[model samples]
Target: MNAEGLRERWATLTRCVCDGARLMVGQGNYDTYVAHIRKTHPDQQPMTPTEFFRERQNARFGVGGRGGFRCC
Candidate 1:
């Protein structure tokens, strides 16, 4: 286990943990979303990070315009 090998393994583990955490939350998967847009709608562009975050937040909390889970 050299320094370089240890660094690579740590980076990989960090990436996996971050990805898993993202999935656990309501935030959408950026890579998968981009791939889907490229495959399905090649002409259209994908949402930017800010736009995507707002969209996800809106979907989860229904803050923007659309309605989400309501506990009335």
Candidate 2:
């Protein structure tokens, strides 16, 4: 591959690795979240990165008494 193409591939691979690590640690991928929201929920506003992080933490730990047993 050309230099630019190799650089792009390396960047993509690095991003995927970082995203996976974040997921393993219970941190959501903000960019992916925004992309999905724009594609699937175009009329709704996407959350700021801080809001998204808080939401993910709440969902993972069931905080704020919003609901119990989210999986159910």
Candidate 3:
């Protein structure tokens, strides 16, 4: 019921997503998860596999290509 508890619960539910596994719906509950994503990212278009992978990499660790880390 606390912040940590809530985060842990979310992490548990999203373990497969965190691990970069393609999403799989189970027990007809896929809509719930997709809805969660839509709610979180209301304005963003869904990314393709290449875009998603690139963005995911840049978000956490920052990627090399695509004008990353410009130094003047």
Candidate 4:
């Protein structure tokens, strides 16, 4: 959905009929948000020091994908 569609839906959910909190829960939708979180973590076997260093070097840094530049 577009930004307007998302905002419209958020508005609807946040408006209450009897003065109760419209945004009742912290998350907008339980299943959609939870499933999103579950999709990001990958399963792998534990790594040795050398292997761990290799993987760590390859991983992105900062908030997203800026990348790691320092050595241990």
Which clashing pairs does model 1 show? none
Model 1 lDDT-worst window of ten? 63-72
11 in model 1: Cα distance from truth in Å?
0.7
lDDT of each: 0.83, 0.88, 0.54, 0.46
**What TM-score does prediction 3 earn?**
0.30
Residue 16 lDDT (model 1): 88
Best by lDDT: 2
The full ranking of all candidates by TM-score, starting with the best, is: 2, 1, 3, 4
**Model 2 Cα lDDT, one tens digit per residue, 1-72:** 899999999999999999999988678899999999999999999999999998988877668886633665
Q: lDDT for model 1, please.
A: 0.83
What's the CA error at residue 67 for candidate 2, in Å?
8.8
Arrange candidates, best lDDT first. 2, 1, 3, 4
Higher-scoring candidate on lDDT, 1 or 3: 1
| Clashing residue pairs, backbone N/CA/C < 3 A, model 3 | none
TM-score of 1: 0.66
Clashing residue pairs in candidate 2 are none
Worst 10 residues of 3 by lDDT: 22-31
**Candidate 2: where are CA atoms >4 Å away?**
65-72
User: Against the hidden true structure, what lDDT does model 3 obtain?
Assistant: 0.54
Task: Give the Å error, residue 23, model 1.
Answer: 1.4
What's model 1's lDDT at 69? 58
Off by over 4 Å in 4: 21-72
